[model samples]
Target: MATDLVRAFVREDLKKSDVVAEVVSLVTVLEQEDFRKLLQEFVDGIDQSMLLDVHLLNGLVQLIRNAPQGYIDVDDLVKILGLLNTRLKDTHKQSTRHTYQLALTISQVLDSMVDSQVKGLSREQLHEPLSDYLEELKQDQDPYLVYQATYAY
Candidate 1:
């Protein structure tokens, strides 16, 4: 419950940013089955406000970057992660450095989550997504992320 409250607080702060709504909207559309919207409709709407809220986005990213199965509040956690791949997918060098930085911060937080003791979560659910994101961080060119993943596993 504490973690949930903490996450909620973080989410509230993120929403205060000018871009959160746009980014969340894009992410929602990305999750949709319509293919035509993913590229045009989604990308056009995203902006720095949504992309640049470092703490809020990172908190959401870390919240779902890695998760355990059977956790009492698993669904709440997983929903947060939906952004890293979609909302943050536009990540790049000059364009999204800060966004990428936030993602990196999330990687660190995710590493901690992986290392932390978990209860009520299934190992499969936890490891799959976490490991996937670990690789994602690696691809993002943050080599240091490996150590955290090593500890987490």
Candidate 2:
């Protein structure tokens, strides 16, 4: 039921910003098990689509930002980071407006994690991949990618 609510919101023709806000609101009230299921569904959705929906990405960021300490464990963080890395690489060769949007959203998600100081997430685990991702983003010709990379740096 919780996952269905999220899917319904995602499928709605609402504005991207509105979709994100709605998802965030819904995510905040979900029980831990429900949240985990939603996250797994999100991972599966990305695996099948090979594209990260900006609304969903932003929603997840908000959830991370507002979640209680220890709500998101290390394993969950790993999955989220892995998904971000994959999307970054998958979109690297494409310089469309959508890809630029994805890059900016990715930056926001990363920023939220840092600002929240997510429990059970270690610097050692974050350092290498994040460094590599930023380095790659810095090399992009797109101004938005450069700005995001710089902001993240």
**Candidate with best lDDT:** 2
- How far in Å is the alpha carbon of 80 misplaced in model 1? 1.0
Q: Which stretches of candidate 2 lie over 4 Å from their true place?
A: 1-20, 96-98, 115-130
- Indicate which candidate wins on TM-score: 2
* Residue 19 shift from truth in candidate 2, angstroms: 5.5
Tell me the tens digit of each residue's lDDT in model 2 across 2-40: 667766754654436675576667766777766666566
**Pairs of residues clashing in candidate 1:** 19-49, 19-50, 69-121, 69-122, 70-120, 70-121, 71-120
Clashing pairs in 2: none
Alpha carbon lDDT of residue 123, candidate 2?
Answer: 63
lDDT of 1: 0.40
Write one digit per residue (lDDT tens) for candidate 1, span 27-144: 3223322222222222232233444555454434422333233321434333333344344445553444554554565455444445544335445655466566555555434444
